[model samples]
Each structure stands twice: as C-alpha cells, then as structure tokens.
Target: MVFAHAPVAIAPLALISLGGLFWLWQKAETPFQSMQIGLGFGLGYFGTGVSWLISSIYLYAEMNLVLSVLAVLCFILFLTLYFILAGWLVARLKTAQRQGFNWVVVMPAVWVFAEWVRATLFGGFPFLMTGNTHLMTWLDGYAPVFGVLGVSWAVAITAGILLWLVQSRAWVGASLVLAVLWLTGASLKNVEWVTPKEKPVEVALLQGNVPQDDKWLSKEFLPTLKRYVGLTKQNLDADIVVWPETAVPAYYDVVERGALRSFIRDAQLLNTDILLGVITRDDSHRDYYNAIVNAHNPEQQYQKKHLVPFSEFFPFSSVLQPLSELFNIPFSEFTPGADDQAPMTLGGHPVGLSVCYEMAFGEELIDSARQADFLITVSNDAWFAHTLEPAQQVQDVQMRALELGREIARSTNTGYTIIVGTNGQLKAEIPPYETGVLRGEVQPYEGETPFVQWRQWPILILLLGVMLLLVWLKLQARPSRKTTAED
Candidate 1:
C-alpha cells in the first residue's frame, strides 16, 4: 500500500482506517485483534498529520533538532488518543446486542463524532480534515454551506454506503446516492448568493519576500519599509493597497517619528487608503497587540482576536516561558484583541481584517464577514517557509470566501498572495516567494448564506434529534436489553 503512490499518503492512511473499520464490523472474533487494528489505523491517520509539527517546533522553537523530533512524535501520539477512544467506541457498539446499529448508524456516528473530537479536543487541530481532500472537485460546493464538518459528513455517508453495498448488495442504493450528490453539486455549481455591485475596487498586495530571521531587526526595518513603500508607490492609483502583517517592523506610534509620517501622509494624499499590519500598545501599560492600522480614516483600527499559541501568545506561559526563552525570538508577548471591534471602512467599503494566525480560526472570520462588505487577511508565512501549509491554508481561505459570499484580499509577507471571489475561485495570485505587487480589481458582493443565517446550531440540533430518535427506537425494540444493561 505504501509503494502505491497513485493513492498518496492520506489515501493510505484512510485505507488503513477502513481496514480497521472492516475488522470491527466483522466482529473480529477476538478483542485483542480488534484493538490491534484500531491502534494501527490510529497511527496511520495521526502519524502523517503530525509531520508538520516537527517543522513548527524547529522553526518556532530553538529546541535541539532531536528534541524537536521527539516533540513531534509526542504530539502525534497525544492526538491519536482521541482516535483511539473513537476506535474503542466503534468496537464497543459492534459488540453490543444491537445488530442493526452495527455498521449502518454506528460507523457514521463514530466517524462524525470522532471528527468533532479531533476538532475540539486538546485546543483543536482542525487541519487536514478529510473533506479538504475533495476541495479540487465538485464536492467543494458543499463546503460553503456545511464548512469542513459538512464535507466530513458527506464523506462518512459515502463510506457507509460503500460498506452497505459490500455487505447487502446495495449497489443500486449507493449508486443512486452518488448520482444525487453529483446532481446536487452541479446545481450548486453556478448558484451565486451575491452579485457584484458598482465598479470593482482596485487593490494591490505587496509581497516583500522578507526573511523571518531579520524581519524585526533594527537594521532591516528601514529597508523593509522602503521596499513596501516603493511597491505601493507604483500602484498608488488603486483604490486600496495592503501590506502583510508586521510588514513595517515598528509600531504605528513609533513610525510617526522621522520620515515615516511624511511617507504615510503621501499615501493618504494619493486618495487611496493603505491598510498595513502594525504592532501597537493598548490602554494597559504593558499590553501589546498584533494589529492593523487604517491610514485612510486614521481613527479606525481593527485588531486580531485569535492569537496563535506560543508564536503570538502563550497559553501556559509559566511553564512554556523557559522553553520559549531558549528560542530567543523577539516581541513574542502578544495580547488578544477585543472580539467586538467594528470592521474598518476603506474607500467607503467595509473591510473585515484578520492578522496572520487569526485566519486559522473560522468562527472569527465568519462573524467579521457578517458585519463587513469584504474580507482581508494579512499574514507573514516566513515561519512556514516553503511548506505545503500555505497552499493548504489558502484552500481553507477560499472555503471561507465561498461560505460568506465575499471577496478576499489575502496579503502575505513572503509569498502566496491570493484574491478569492465569492464562488471560491482564485481571482488573482502571486507565485510563492515572488516579490511583486499583485494588483487586481475586486468587486464588492452582498447577500447572506444559510451558514451566515443559522450558523451550525441548526445542524447540531438536527444531529441531536437523530441520535435521540435512534436511541429511543433501540429502547422500544428491546426493553429487556436496556434493563439488563443498566442492571
């Protein structure tokens, strides 16, 4: 299976998991064998997922290389615990007297519930969701409405149907389901929720290609500022221009000194609003924030609500502080911004802004999108370097755009600057590590989606209702079994 490269690593991982699930469905004949398959499957799924942790530790922490490897292993093992429990639950349900629930409901239930556990347990690592693999295909239409969780549901249901076909000769039913899904996808293909109004807003995204090593150093600050300003000057006619997070090393208050103020004044004079990420001091004496300052109105500012653990803000600092000091990365003490701040208006258009790490959290972006006309995410991906994470991250961003029916102007410090339309289409993008201004005209869109109206509460209630009905029916079928089990 490993030698067959056509299916890829994640496919192998899923296949291993499917093998374990099949063994569970067949009654395994022995508890040890059932648990053994579960363990192997859990390792396959998590071991591949945690490969990025090694890069994260090495890049973010100055830990010894060997220690970083060990950290990756430990993190993967820790994540596997959730999958292990999920495996055990599935096996238990199979062993129960309820034969009807064995494969039909139990498999899908455990799969969806296990994914929920994966998303929320241990501070949540919602990356690499199985639904993400279908992003390049017709299944992407389901993403805007259901988010990743919805995609996961479809995947699990398909898997269940496959199992049904194998056991009960339900090929016709499985084929019908597949046909309906494809037809629904086709119908959703051109169903746009919002129409663009007025002329497109021309914007420029400046990618400085700045190295993370020297981004914050005193000597590199002036050169970095000059590079961004030079790019901005070339595209000043654009309605709005943006720079990546911390594109300017100093805070807005600090940048007022010397020629910085004059440079900004020129930008404002050009009648274009320039939005750039800046570090700023809050009312509290020692508190700092990773924030975006609006040069258009001057008074309007939006700060990042969700801070990255360890990199932006440490959760358990008392314990992690010593380990952080070992890295020696500067200005890492970041404070979380208010969750209720209003979106900033640039060139008469409301722009919902998110700093680097905030993009990882879908909830915050969804909330901000509701109140704003457009979406803007500024990030510095120098930490991830040339890893597949950036590409994967943009895919998630596109999903958010489709979900919200809003245009996004995503600016990055190093590379992968992208603009996504409401349909999850890549409007414009710069090549990774390319140093240039990606100038494009993005039209503002308006309207609401099902996701925007009800959020996930409706889906949650529906799932709960199904579970309750299933349990009640099981109870009605076998009153004696329930009594004996309780006894």
Candidate 2:
C-alpha cells in the first residue's frame, strides 16, 4: 500500500490523478473545458485524499457507520472544488498554439498556488499537501535546499514534462526528466548532512491508546493519567518522556490539583523531563489554549499556534456554531497561541515543539526548527484510526525534519509514533492503534541548514519576481497592433 509506509512515493500518482482529469476534459468538449478538467483533477485528488475521514470518525471516534462514511465522502467531494479551480486556471491560460509558453514554469506555479489556496481557503485543510509526500524519495534532498516548495516545483516540472511528452511524443525528454529524479535520489542517499556528535539521548513516548469517546469523561480521567504515568514510570531511565496531545484532559486551571506537578517533580528526581499536552487557560478563563506544557519547569510552555478548523474553533462560530456541533465537532472552542513562541528546552537542548496539525505547515515548522536543536510533536490521532491519514501525516513530519535538518520525536495517543532522523529516515517507529512507548537515541546537531536560516518566503518572492519580469519582457516583445495590422 503506497498509502502506508511508502507514502512519499505518491508524487508520481498525481500524474495519474491529473492526467485522468485532462482526459475527462477532452471528452467533455465544453467552453470551460480547462475548468472542467481542473474540477475532474480535484475530484480525483480529494476523493482519495479525505478517505481517511472514514477511519477517523467511525473506527476511532466510534461514530455511526453510515453517517461516518457519508461524512468522509462529503468532505472529500467538498475539497475537490479547489482542484477544479486549479485545472480551470491552467486550461484557461493556454496560448493560441494550444500549448502554454512553458509548462515547467506554469505547472509549478499553478500547483503551488493551488496548494497555497487549499491551505488558506475556507479555514484551510492543508493535509496531504503534495509537497509532504516526497519525504522517502531522494527527491527530498531538494527540501533542505528549497523547502517543500522545491519538491513541489520538481513535481510540477515532472508533470509538465509528462504533458509535453503527451503533446509531442518526445519520449527522450520524458526519459531524461525521470533519469534526473533517479540520479538526484541516488546522490542524496550518500549525503550526510547531520553528524551525530553527542551521545544519543534516550526518549520514551507514551501512547495511552485512550478511546476518543471516553478520553475526556470524568470516570476515565484517572485511568488515562495513570496509563501515561505508569508507562513513564516504567521508562524512568529515559532522558526525555513525552505524552501525546491533551494527555491531561481537563483545562489546567480547573484541574491543576498539583498532582501532575508532583509527578513531574518525581520525574526530575529521576533526572528526566516530561513533555505533556494539556489544556491551558488564561486568568480570564476566556483564552483556552491547546498547549504543550513542561511538568518539571513552570517557566516553559509551548502553545499551539495553528488550530484545526471546526474542531478547534469554527471559522464563523456565531453563525455556524449549532451546525458545527450538530456534526460532532471534537474541540469547538480553542485559543490559538502567538506565532513567535520560543522553542522549549529540555535537558539543556532546544526542543522545538508543535502541536498536532501544526506539523503540516512546512514553513512554520522549518522556521521553528531554525532556533531549536530538535523538533518535537504531540498528537492524539484517536481522531484518525488505522487510516492513510496518519501515515500521510507522519510522512509530512519526516519531511519537516529533512527540510529543517532536525531530529523529530513525534508521539501520538493512538499510535504511529515515530523517531525520524535529519535525513527523514524512520530510525524507529511504533505502529498505529498500538499501546506502547518508542525509545531511541537522538543526537541534536548545532549547524544550521539553508532552509533553517532562510525560509520559503525568500525563495517564493524570487520566483515571483522572475515570472513577473518574464511577463514584462513578453509584453515588450509583442508587435504593436498598428504595425501588425498593416503587415
């Protein structure tokens, strides 16, 4: 299953995805054929994209099976609208020759623009971003050099080459592009960007495997806490122990009974630091944050900057609150953290922390990695059980490590917990739906990556400028209307 471990190889699948739409558009023979093609592409892309929603709702949350399947289909169909627009744009821009000026440039631009649109529009579900799927393939070495945007660019270029081959039957050109990807991947396999200097730090990640339905119930609270604590106690020799998102269920202000603090103090007694996910509230009790708080130190707190749509907070809750809840939203009211939260420190090393869903945004995670020695994430995938979603999501996290040159320690409540190296290899991992802890040695590096220092914004601006400059030159080259008519 490409959807399982080898998710990074799915970029080529997009060719099948997009090409199928183009064929459909050819059959339609309509005025807005390009637009129709785009819609077709979107349908295929998102139809399969949101299939994980079935697992999330039915298997994980135990929702009614029929409604859960319907919900997943509806979500996928809804997300398909964006792909339609993407296809429309590409088709609409075709020159009189039935071919665009440069598909290489146009394809990447359109796809990147589409992905960006998908990430921001309608509260933005940026999951399964095409860029994330490139992790396992050596095509990802371009990540550290160009970020996910670069891999996205390469993917677009490959699409363009394929399109060109289709139009002109130029097999040589297509073969060359494929060869380049192969060679690049081969070269990257040998490249050692991060050297492990310090002795490996042993980490223990606790997966309580708490059922989503009972996780927040009063009766289940003690058992849930005990599950995590008991697991950590078993791994006391670990240098760092982590629990997945909201391992502590209630808001801290209400439940800060000092019980967790006492446990943290004991962990400190063991010379280990426990990084936990908990709900935190401000003095006014108005701002409740989805946060990662350290038990050993009161000073360190990592609040989640990116909150999930509908689940965290309805985009327009006042108007849609009733409708959102009617659909069984997980967390309908959560506060977002400030963008510039500092990386948390544990055992004297900077650990850049991001909550679940935050890892999907490559730029933000990479920027955070710039300052931190390693990357850490806490998640409760009790939302998406035994689906391609978690696998795809993990690949995204792995790419973040590769792009930013940081070690990743990801702990999930319902499994798929993994340890990834700077090169994006799964050095260690725990499977989905399993109750266990993953322990491994991680050597945090000190050197900075180009992506770590200079983020995606600079590269994007440069690309935009070049495209704009090209447009300006093309306008200048066009013959004057009067002269052309006289000729």
Candidate 3:
C-alpha cells in the first residue's frame, strides 16, 4: 500500500498489497486475530506513508522533536484504528456459506467504506487512497465514471478476486471476472465525457519557491512580495497570471493599496487578470481568511471552504486548545469560505477554485466545476520539506482533473506546480523548490463528467445496500429458537 503512492507509484502494488491483507483476514482464526492483522498492516502502511507529518510538525510547526514524533504517531495510530475495526468486520463474513460472495462483494465494499471514513474523519487525511495509484493505468478510466472511490472499488474487487483464487475452487469464474473488469476498464478509457471549447486560455503560474521558515520573517516579507509581483510583471502577456497560496505573505490590507492596485491596474490595462493569494480579514476584523484575491476585480475573491483539520481549524476546538498551545501552529483561526461562494471568472473564463489542500476533496470542487471552464488550486506545500507529500499532492490534483474532465492550473509555493489536462495527464510543470513561472495553455472544457454530475451518491448507496443485504441473508440463515421453553 505504501508503494502505491509516490515516490514509488507502481500501480499494481496497490491491489497486490491489499490482497495480502485480505489473505490474512481469511486465515485469521478469530475476529481478534483479524483485528491484530489490521493493526500490524495499519502501522506499516500509514507509518511510512505519512512520515511527512513529522516534518510538518517538527520543522514547520516548530514543535519540539520529541513531541512531534509523539503527535504524528498518535495521529497515525488513530487512522490505524479504522482498519483495525474493518479487520474485525471482514472476519464476520468468515462464517457465511457463500464464501464467493463474501470475497467478491462484501470485502471490497467494506474496504471502500473504510477509505471514505478515513478520508472524512477529523477533517480528512486523504493521503494514499488506493484508487490514486492508477493514474495512467486502465483502471483510471473508472475515475471519470465513479470518482476515486470508484477506482478504489475496482482495485479492491480485484484484490478480493486474488484472495478467492488462492483460497477457493472457483478458478475459472474468478479469472473471467478479472478479465471482464480489466477489459471493461480499458474500454472505458476511450470514453470522452467532456467537450472542450475551442479557445485555450494561456496561463502563467508563478512559483516563488519561498522557504516556509523565512516566509513569515519581516525581512523576507517585502522581498517575497516584490519577487512574486516581479514574476507576474514578466508574464503580463499571458491570458491569466496566478501566484501560489498566500503569495502576498501579508494581510490583504497590509500591501500598499496604491502600489498593489497600480500593478493590477496596469495588468488589467493589458487585458490580463491577476489571481493571487493573501490573508484577508472581514470588516469587523473578528474573522480572518486564507483567500484568493482577484487583482483585476477585488470584490470577486474566493476564500477557501475546505479547511485542513489541524492547521486551519481544530476538529474539536474547546478540547484541542491545550494541544494548540503545545503545537504553536499558525493559521489556526481561519473562517471557512461559504459553501455556495461563486467561482471566479479569470481571463473571461469561469474557473473552479481551491486553496492549499482543499483539492483533496473532489466533491467540494464539483459545485465550482459544474459550471466552470477549468480549475485552479493555489497551494503552499513548502512544509513538506523535500518529502513525497508534494508529489502525492500532484496526484490528488490529477485525480480531480480526471474526475471533472477539466484542465487544472495548479500553482504552489516551492514546487510541483503543474498543468493537468482533462484526462489527468501532466501537460506542463516546473521543478519543485525553484523560483520560476510555469507558462502553459489549458483548453477550457465545457461539459460535466458523470462523476461530477452524480458525485459519489450512486457508489456510496450501492456499497451500503450490498452490505445490508448480506446482513439480511445472514439473519435469514440463523438457526430458529426452540419453544419447548415454556420454562
């Protein structure tokens, strides 16, 4: 499972690794033993997969070395609990007579639910979703139809088949099922869901590559602001110019209004719309926001709605206050943007918007993407500190692009700034940790993919329904109670 994501990215490893766990669940003599298997698998999987968290805690959050390790381990252990419970759930199917149904349907369904619960719990750590492994593979075709969870379903089902192949006598049936899945997935690859509009918007994404440590420094503030503005100034000829999240490095009001507006006015005069990130405070100053500023149209800005749990806001505020004191995290009080906030129009094109890690939630962006021509995600991932997190984030953006079948303009501080086409293909990008501008043309797509149209409702409903049906079958097969009882 750890090998499913960067920096390994071998697609087959996702299902193969999961198959091993399914095998263990089959072999366990008791539910507790299955739970033990889950515990061990969870420890190995999330321990290595989420090691980046320690860097975010120790280096960026500036927590003590010992505390950072403790915090990350605690968090990983919490995530592991989900799988531990899932293991117990899978073991419940062990006694069912329809062993084939148990493997083919119930096990994969449980795994899908586990993935969703893991992603949604505690503001979601959506790292290393099993579906994210099939970026360029045939299974990625499922992404457009069912979203990442659907892709996860395809992967999970295959693992179940592998489990059945090893343990059951249904060899030919399993082989045929496997063939149909892959062949159908490959055929779906040729399916086109979105109609691309004729005009392509040339976008200039600016990566200032500012060090996270120096980003808040008073000495570096002015230089960083000037550096981003200078980069934008050099790209005035593009249809749209963008900078990464909080590229302003100050409150929205802190920048000399005249100077900043003057630059925007100059760019507007040349028909360019500049979209950049800055922290902004609402009128009463009681509410602060991590927002995108539409330099050409100040009032038409997008604040981030999906706040990352720990960094942007505490999961349980009253309870986590003490933990905050120890962590000393920044941006802990940001107010989320409105759920129905309007998408911005840049370069005369409707654009879906996300700031920082908001790209992790595909459903949240669907509202913006439904009526938009393309998507934009501005992030500052410098805290990742040369880890695989940035690459993993790029994959998230790619999956979103595929899900919506719309091109994405992703600008980030320090690296992995990229242009993802509607098919989840990397069209263009600049090297991470380098100060540069990635100039590319993204063609605007004008239609909705099925995943965007229905979201995850169909898939979620189907999985839960199957699980309930299996429970009903189990109950029907239960031994009847004897009434010789009158005693």
Candidate 4:
C-alpha cells in the first residue's frame, strides 16, 4: 500500500502484497487467526500509507506531536476493522478448501468489496485505494471502462492467480497469464473514448505558495490578496485564470466590493474569465459554503458538495464541536452544496469544478462533468506541506481526468498546480512551495467514458454475483462434510 502512493509509487509492488495476503489466508488454521493477521497487515499498510495525516494534525491542528501520533493510530485502528471483516468473511466462506475457486474468484471479490465499503461508509477516507497505484500502468486504460474499483479488482485477481502459480510451482503458466494481462492493458491505452469538442483554450493556473501559518492572519490578508491579483494580471492574456481554495481569504460579500470587483472589471476588459475559491454566505439561511465563483460573473457559482471530514465539517458536530474548539481548529464547519447544481460556464465552455478534497469523490464529479467540456479543481494543500499528500492528490486528479475523458486544470496553494490532458497524462506543472503560474491550453472534450455513464454499478453487480456464488458453493459443500463425519 505504501508503494501504491506517491513519491516512490512502484504500483506493481501491490501485487506482492496481495500475493502475501493470499498466502496468509491459506495458512491460517482458524477464522480468528485469519482476522488477527488481517488486522496486523492493515495496521502496517495504512499506518505507513497515510502517515502524512500526522503532519497535518500536528502542524495545522496545533496538536502536540505525541497526541497527533496517538490520534493517527486510533484512526488507523478504526479503518483496520474493515480488513478484519474481510478476513473473517473469507474464512467463513471456506474458500481455501475449494480448489481452483478460492484464490482466483473468492479472494479478489472479498478484497475489492472490502475496499468499496471503506470508500463508501462513514464519510469515506478513500486515500490510497489499490487501483490508484495503476495510474501510470496499462491497467489505467481500464479506468475509463470501469473506474478505479474495477482496476483494483483486476490487480487483485492477477495477484491471486500469481499466488496460485507460486503454490503449484507452475512458473511458466504464471508468466503467460501475466503477459496477457499486461498486453491487453497496453492495447486498451490507445483507445480514445472521448473526442475533442472545441478549440483549445489557454488557461492560467496560479500557485500562490501562501504559508498556512500566515494565510488567515489579519496582518497578512492584504498582501496575500494583492499577490493573487498580481498573478492574475500577469496572466491576463489567457482565456481563463484560476485560483486555489480560499484564495481570497475573506467572505464573498466582503471581497466582492473591494479587490474582487476590480478583478472582475479587469477580466471583462481582457475578455477573460476568472474562477476563484471563496467562502460564501447565504444571509437568509445563515449558512456558510466552501464555494467557487466566477470573478467576472459571481452569479455563476458551484458550491462544494463533498466536504472533508473533521476539516471542512466535523461528523457528529454536536458531540465533537467542543473538542474541536479545544484543539484550536478553525473553519472546521461548512454546509454542503446541492447535489444537482449545474456546471459554471466560462470561456465559451462549461466547466466542472471541485474544491480541494471533493476531487476524491469520482461519482460526485461525474454529474457535473457530464455536461462540462473541461474539469477544474482548486486546493490549498499547505496544511500537508512536506508530505506525500500533495503528490497523491495530483494522482487522484489525473485519474478523474481519465475517467471523465476531459482535460483538467488543477490550481493549488503551495504545490502541484498541474494541467492534465484528456488521457490522464501530465501536460504542465508548477513546482511545490513556489509562487508560479502553470500556463497551458486545455482541449475540451465532448463525450463520456463508460465510467461517467455507468459509474460503479457494473463492478458492484459483478462482486455481488461472485459473493452469492461462493455462498451457494459453501452450502453445497456442507452436506458432503456432514456425510463424511457420519461415516
């Protein structure tokens, strides 16, 4: 799992881990022991994979280093229960006793289903999902057809087959099967699912590089706002310009009458459109939203639908709000936007926008992307500076582009402001912790990949079928074992 994340993402290493899991399941003498082994593996895998969380807690939350570590441990332990459950199910199904069925069919089904549950339940922390490792691999072609979970299923099944070959000492057969899988994936890469719709439009993505400690400070507010304004002016020739989440560092009403108004006026003069992240308030309802708005036309806006847990909005706020205040966490509450909100029109094209962590929800993005010509995501990653969090985030954005078959413009505060092509390949990027502009032309796409249309339904149905079949096999085997016991 650690190898599946960024900086040193050798994605193929995931197969070795999956193979080891198969071996563990085969060797365990009891269901309880299998679950224990699963728990131990989950702890180690997630502990290292998401270790970056500790940096965010300690640096941004202002928690003590010791408390931060303990907090991360508690979170890892809670997530590990999912793995434990998968192990118990695999054991209960007695897949190990079913030759030619356990490793190939049952194990992969169990593993992928567990991952799906983890990504769906309890607000979901879908970080480091297995298929994300295949971003640069041939398996990435499968993303458009079945999404990340489908790719994960493919990897798990391949690993299970390799485990079977190792146990049976059939190295030649394993090599052939592996070659076929890789070759098929490579061939799929050349298939273009979505075609270009309009002429390419030049875009300027700004990386403000604001320090988290000074971002919200009253003394630094004016200077930060000026910096972004200056950057926009520098790239005014582009058809569209973008800023990171909370780039304005003030309420929409407050900024709209001040520098924001000037930005709108200047953009209109240049025949350019500007999209920026800001905190918006609805006075009548007294609700605050983390939203993106068009500086040239504030009426065109998209509020973030999916909010990050404990960061944008705390779960069980009535119980956790007091504890959050004690820890000095600011801006920890936000209301979600409507699920059916339309895409914003910009630069003669419809744009799908996601604010920071919302980019992780692929299904949520599909609705907006269905009518959008291009996709845009804005983020402030300073909370996780000096960690792999930003790199992993860039990868996730790349996957979204591939799944939707649209070019993506990603703007960020303090790192990885990148432009990705419709094929999920990086076109341009600004270095981390630097103030710079990523200038590129995004070729808007017109059509959808299979993933955009079907989403997770196909994969879920396939997994469900596999589970039911395994249950039937177990039931059929029960009577045979009883007869042998009677004899």
Task: Give per-model CA RMSD.
Answer: 3.8, 3.5, 2.2, 1.9
Off by over 4 Å in 1: 1-39, 95-104, 121-123, 166-168, 283-285, 469-487
Q: Model 4 reaches what TM-score against the true structure?
A: 0.95
Clashes of 1: 0
Q: What is the lDDT of residue 391 in candidate 4?
A: 90
Instruction: Quote the RMSD, in angstroms, for model 1.
Output: 3.8
Per-residue lDDT over 1-487 for candidate 4, one digit per residue giving the tens place of the 0 to 100 score: 6776686788768889988887888778899988998898899888887888877788777887787888889999989998999899888876555533577778888999999999899878778888888887888888888888888888988888888787776677667777887788787778989998868989999999999889888999899989999999888889899989988898888888885777676665667788888899897646789988888777888898888887778889998877676355556788999988888888899888888888887877888889999989999989889888899898888888888888889999998899998778899887899999999999988988989999989889988998999899888767687688998
Tell me how many clashing residue pairs each candidate has. 0, 4, 1, 0
Instruction: Tell me each candidate's TM-score.
Output: 0.87, 0.87, 0.95, 0.95
Q: Mark the 10 consecutive residues where model 2 has the least summed lDDT.
A: 1-10
lDDT of candidate 2 over 180-249, digit per residue (tens): 8657856765666656556667889888889887886889988888888899889878888898999998
All models: lDDT?
Answer: 0.70, 0.72, 0.86, 0.84
lDDT value for candidate 1?
0.70
Write down the TM-score for model 1. Answer: 0.87
Q: Any idea what lDDT model 2 has?
A: 0.72
Error of 2 at 341 (Å): 1.5
lDDT of 1 by residue, 269-343 (tens): 668888877888855648888888767656777777877766676778887887776555566788788988888
Sorting all predicted structures by lDDT, with the top scorer first, yields 3, 4, 2, 1
